[model samples]
Structures are given as structure tokens and as C-alpha cells.
Target: MLQIKDLQARVEDKEILKGINLEIKPGEVHAIMGPNGSGKSTLASVLAGHPGFEVTGGQVLFEGQDLLDLKPEERAREGLFLAFQYPVEIPGVSNMTFLKTALEEIRAHNGLPAFSAKEFMKLLREKQDLVEFNTSLVNRSVNEGFSGGEKKRNEILQLAMLNPKLAILDETDSGLDIDALRIVAGGVNKLRSSENAFLVITHYQRLLDYIVPDVVHILSGGKIIKSGPKELALELEEKGYDWLREVETTE
Candidate 1:
């Protein structure tokens, strides 16, 4: 559902993503693993149309549309979801209110009717249960005073409610206890289906133990240097990223 070809991007004068080529089809989960400053998150940010980064070269197509041409909100309305590495807090906006407005806007963009009050509540309940989100937090401000785990789960909750065709999870497992990690992963697993795809960016192999990506890619020097099956993550866990330097040199 998404295709990226020789995608290059830069922040100010320094280039980050250099010729990143990837394609994610529906029903597939792709994991990108890299060390610090490898531009893994930059790819996610670029895909989500972050204004800070400028697209210098190549193309990105989302469901055959030129993704780069759309504004960030337009991209979201088009079924592209980016779960931030650090989910920001909106002090005055309640979580429920934020999600309701987002969902309604997306639906309206696609010419769908807004959910009735009862219907909205029912849908909210289902998604909250799916993500194992704290119902009590629903009435609280978005990510305001939330723990790291709570913030991540809230991201998953938003993902569930939006039901985007392509979800880009940028370091969702960055901070969590094992139990919280399992809950978050479980929610993601349950949400997987033939109609949607996921691009997961993480640093550890442990995250892959639960999400079980269909493909694992090694990104370095702002380029995808290696891609293999899920077992690649295990190899990376054991061999470390240093060995990939040889791979990059050869390429």
C-alpha cells in the first residue's frame, strides 16, 4: 500500500535519509532496526510529512497517490498514522475529545457520516479494550501527566480508533516494563489484518519477539543496507550493528 523509491530527505543542510527504497503491502509488518543517528526515525518523520525535513529527491506513493504532495493532516486523513517516539502532551484537550474530533474529521474527509453519540461510545470502548488502555485516563488531558507506558498505550489507542491503512510506529517500545510492552504488543497483534500494514521502528530485538515482523531491515548511513526475514533481528541481536558496516562497505 506504500512505495518509497530512492527517497532522500534533509534537515537544514545536512541530509538524513539517502536513497531509502521500501515497499509495504497490506497484511505485512516491516521492522526497521538501526543504531543511534541512523535515520530510522527520519524515514518515519519524512513519511508523515514533518515540515522540518525537506524532500530532496525520489518519490513516495501511498495507495498510488503522491504522498509527498499532501499536507500532514491530509496524509493522516488518507490513512497514514505516525505514532511519535515522544508523544506530546496537550494539556487542555481531553483524550476522548481529541480522538473523537480526529476520527470524525477523517471519516468526513472520506464522505462518511459522523458516529452517533452511542455509536462513538461503543467504538471507543472497543478500542480502549483492544489497547488495554486505562479507561479512567479517557477523561484526562491528552498525555498530560501520563507515565511513559501510558503515553505509548494512548498512542496505540489512537491507532485503534483511527484504523489507518498504514501505521508507522516510531519507537513505540522505547520505554516500557515487560508487562506494559506485552500489553502494547498484544493490542497491535490483535489489530493486524489483511487490510492494513505496519512499519515498526525499534532498536531492540525484544520488540520483534512479540510483533514478529514479516521483514526486517537494517538501516545505516541513512540508507537501508540490508533486509532479511524475521530471523535477521536475531542475528542483529547477537552480532551487533558493527558487522553491518562490512555489509554497507560492500554495497
Candidate 2:
């Protein structure tokens, strides 16, 4: 569903991703793990069209359409959802109102009439069940005073509501307790289907245990140096990234 070719990027003037190429097909779950400062987050930011990062070269295609040419909101309206590592808080907006407005925006983009208040609330109720969301959160301002776990839960709530064709989760496991991680992973597993794709970015193997991936890729120095099945994650956890470091040294 997504294809990235020779993707290179930078922030200010420092280059990050260098000639990175990766493809994710519909119905597949792929994980990206890398050391710090290896451009993992840079790739995500570039793909989402974050203005701070510049794509000096390469192209990203979502189902054959040029993705970088589209604005961030346009990408979302087209079924691209990215769960940020740190969720943003909007103090003046009620969560329910914000979600309703976002839904209307996406609907308008899709050539559908805006939902009535009752209709919007109905959809909210359904997706809340999908993510086990509490009514208290819906009543509060978006992400305001939410704990780390709560913030992660709120992201899943968006996933359930948005139903993006490609969900790029950047470090969803960070700062989550075991229980919170399981809850979040369960929500992700529930959302997976034959028609959607997942690009899971994580640091450790623990999250992979809950939401098993079809494939696991080791990203090093801004590029994927190894790709394998689920067992690769297990190996990485057992051996550490040192073995791969050794391989790189020898090569």
C-alpha cells in the first residue's frame, strides 16, 4: 500500500535518512527498529509531510499516488494515520468536539455530507467500544492532563475512528506499562484487517509479543540492513543489536 524509493531527508542542514527504500503491502505488519539518531523518526516525519524535515530526494507513493505532493491534512483525508510518539494536547477543544470536527473534515474530503450531531456521537460510541475508551476522556479537552498511557489510548481511539488505510505507529510502546502496552496492542490487533497495512516502529521486542508482525526489519544508519520474519525480533532481543553491529564491522 506504501512504497518509498531512495528516501533521503534532513532537518535544517543535517542529513538523516540516506537512500532508504522500503515497501509495505496491504494486510502486512512491518516493524522498524534502530539505534538512537538512526533517522527512524525522521522517516516518519518526512512521510507525514512534517514541514521541518525536507525530502531533498526520492519519492513516497501511497497506492500509486505521490504522497509528498499532498498536504498533511490531505493525506489524513486520504486514509493515512500517524500516531505520534508524543500526542499533542489541545486545551480549548473538547475531545468530542475535536473528533466531530475532524470526522466532518474527512467526510467533506470524501464527498460525503457532514454528519449530524447524533450520527457523529453514534460513531463515537462505537469506536469507543473498539478502543475501550472511557466517557470521561471524551468529555475532557483532547490529551489535556492525560497520563502517558491515556495519551496512547487516545491515539488508538483516533485509529478506531479514522480507520486509516496505512497506520504508521511511531514508537507506540515507549513509556507504556505492561498492562497499558497490552491494551494498546490489543486495540491495534483488533484494527488489523486484510485491506489495511501497519508500519510499527518500536525499540524493543516486548511490544512485538503483543502485536506480532508478519515481518521485522532492522534499521541501521538510516537504512534497513536486515529483514526477516518474527523470529528475527526474538533473536535481536536475545543477542542484542551487537551481533548486527559486528556483522556491519566485518562487512
Candidate 3:
């Protein structure tokens, strides 16, 4: 569903991603594991069309369309979702209102009519049940007073509502305890289907225990250095990333 070729991006004259070439097809779950400053989040941000980063070279095609050419909102409307490592809080905007506006916007993009209030409430309840999201949280402002796990769950709830073609979860496991991790991962796993794909970016293997990626990639020095099966995550957990770094330097 997504193809990236030699993707290079920079922020404020400092390049982060260097020649990132990867393809994620429908029904596949790919995990990207890397050390600090390895450009994992940068890849996610660039793919999501975050304005803070500028693409210097290479091309990204989403279902044969030029993804880099689209604006961030355009990317979202095109069915690309990025679950941030830190979900921002909008104190005045209730979660329900935020989700309704986003969902309607997406529907409008797809040439569908907006949902009526009753239809929206029904849809919200269904998605909440799908993610096991607390109804009370929906009444509050987005992530305003939520705990770390709650914020992550809220992201998953958004994911369920949007039903994006490709979901890029940037360190969704960060700051989550074991239970919260399981809840978030479970929600993601439940949403997996043959028509959608996932790009899971994480540093540790614990999250993989729940999500079980179809492929695991080792990213280092601003590029993906190794790609392997799910067992690769176990190997990385056992051996760590130093061995990969050494191999990269020597090669």
C-alpha cells in the first residue's frame, strides 16, 4: 500500500533520514526497531507529511500516488494515519467533537455525506467498544487529563474510527505499562485485516510480543540495515543493537 524509495529528509539543515527504501503491502505488519537518534521517528514524521521536516530527495508513493506532494491533512484524507509518541492535548476540544470533525472531514474527502448526530453517536459507541475505550473519556477534552495509557488508548480509538489504509504507530508503547501496552496492542491486532497495513516503530521487543509483525527491520545510522522475520525481534532483544551498529560500520 505504501512504497518509499531512497527517502531522504532533513530538519533545519540537519539531515536525519538517509536513503530509506521500504515497502509495506496490504495485510503485512512491519516493525522498525532502532537505537536513539537512528531516525525512526523522522521516517514516520516524513511519511505523515509533518511540515517540520523537509524532504531533500527520493520519492514516496502511496498506492501509486505521490505521497510527498500532499499536505499533512491531505495525507490523512488519503488514508495515512500516524499515532504520535506523545499525543497533544487540546483542552477546549472535547474528544467527541474532535473525532466527529475528523471523521466527517475524511468522509467528505471520500465523497460521502456527513453523519447525523445520532449516527455519529452510534458510530462512536461502536468504535469505543472495539477499542474498549471508556465512554467517560470521550466527554473530556482530547488527552487533556488522561494518563499515558489512556492517551495511547485514545490514539487507538482514533485509529478504529478512521480505519486508515496504512497506520504508522510511532513508539506507541512508550510510557505505557504492561497492561496498557496489552490493551493498545490488542486493539491494533484486532483491527488488522487483509486490506490494511501497519508500520510499527518501537525500540524494545516487548511490544512485538503482542503485535507480532510480519517483518522486523533494524534501522541504524539513518537507514534500514537489516530486515528479517518476527524472530528477528527476539534476536534483537537478546543481542541488542550494538552488533548491528558494528556490522554497519564495518560494511
Candidate 4:
């Protein structure tokens, strides 16, 4: 559903991603694990068309369209969703209002009509049940006063509601307790389908146990050094990144 070729991205004058190449098929989940400052999160940011990052080279194709050509909102309109590791709080925007606006925009882009408040709430409740998202937060400002778990769950709640074709979750496991992690994983698993794909960026192998990956890629020094099944994650967790790097250097 998504393919990136020789992806190179920079923040300001400092380049972060160097020649990243990955392809994700629908119904597949790919976990990207890397040491700190290895450009893992940069890849996610670049894919989502974040304005702060510049594409120095390469192309990203979302179902055949050049993703770099689209604006961030346009990327979202084209069925790309990126759940940020750090969700920003919009003090003036109510959670329900923010979601409704996004839903309407996406619906329009997809040639669907806007939802009435009742219809929107009905859809929201259904999605909430799917993700087990709490209803109390819906009326509050987006991300305002949300606990770490709540922020992550709200992100997944949006995912469940939008039903994007491809979802890029950058560091979804960060700051989450075991219970929260399971809840987040459950929400993501519920959304998995033949027409959707997931790019899960994480540091620990524990998250992999909850959301099994079709492929595990070890990214280090800005490139993928090892690619294998879920067993690769276990190997890394057991042996540490130092061993993985040593093995990569030998290869």
C-alpha cells in the first residue's frame, strides 16, 4: 500500500534520513526498530509530508501517487495517517470538533457527504467501542489535560474513525504502561485488514509481542541493516543493538 525509494530527508540543514527504502503491502505490519538518532522517526515524519522536514532525494508512493508532491493535509486526504509520538495539545479545539472537521474533510475528499452532529456522534460512539476509547474526553479540548495513555488512545480513536489505508505509528509504545499498551495494540489490531497496512516504529521488543509483525527491520545509522521475521526482534532484545551492529558490520 506504501513504497519508499531511496528516501532522504533533512530537518533544517541537518539531514536525518539517508536513502531509506521500504515497501509495505496491505494487511502487513512492519516494525522499524533502531537505536536513538538512527532516523527511524525521520522516515515517519517525511512520509507524512511534515513541513518541518525536507526531502533531499527519493520518492514515496502511496498506492502509486508521489506522496512528496502532496501537502500534509493532502496526504491525509489520500488515506495516509501518522500518529505522532508527541501529540500536540490544541487548547481551543474541542476533541469532538477537531475530529468532526477532519472527518468531514476526508469525507469530502472521498466524495462523501458531511455528517450531521447526531450521525457524527453515532459514528464516534461506534468507533469508541471498537477502540474502547473513553467518551468523557470527547467534549474536552484536544489533548488538553490528557494523561499519556489518554493521548495515545485518542490517536488510535482517530485511526479507528478514519479507517485510513495506511497508518504510520511512530513510537506508539512510549510512555505507555502495560495496560495502556495492550489497549492501544488492541485498537490497532482491530483495524487491521486486507486493504490496510501498518508501519510501527518502536524501540522495545515488548510491543511486538502484542502486535506481531509480518516483518521486523533493524535500522541503524540511517539504513536498514537487518530484515527478518518477528524472530529478529527477539534476537535483538536478547543480544542488544551492539551485537546487531557488529553482525551488520561483519555482513
Of 1 and 3, the candidate ranking higher by lDDT? 1
Q: Report lDDT per candidate.
A: 0.96, 0.89, 0.94, 0.91
Task: Count clashes in each candidate, considering only residues at least 3 apart in sequence or on different chains.
Answer: 0, 0, 0, 0
Expressed as tens digits, the lDDT of each residue in 136-222 for candidate 1 is 999999999999999999999999999999999999999889999999999999999999999999999999999999999999999
lDDT of 2 by residue, 1-251 (tens): 89999999889989888888889999999998877787888888888889999899998999999999999999999989899999999998999988888888888888989888888889889888876789999999999999999999899999888888999999999999998898899999999999999999988999999999999988888778888999999998899977779856766
- TM-score of candidate 4 on Cα atoms, chains taken together: 0.98
Once model 1 is optimally superposed onto the true structure by TM-score, how far is the C-alpha of residue 95 displaced, in angstroms? 0.7
Ranking by lDDT: 1, 3, 4, 2
lDDT of 3 by residue, 121-213 (tens): 998898898667899999999999999989999999999999999999999999998988988998899999999999999999999999999
CA error at residue 42 for candidate 3, angstroms: 0.6
For model 3, name the residue pairs that clash.
none
RMSD of each: 0.7, 1.2, 0.9, 1.0
lDDT of 4 by residue, 153-186 (tens): 9999999888899999999999999999999998
| Residue 133 local lDDT, model 3 | 88
Highest lDDT scorer: 1
Candidate 4: which pairs clash? none
Q: How accurate is candidate 4 locally (lDDT)?
A: 0.91
Q: What is the lDDT of residue 251 in candidate 4?
A: 88
Candidate 2 vs candidate 3, lDDT winner: 3
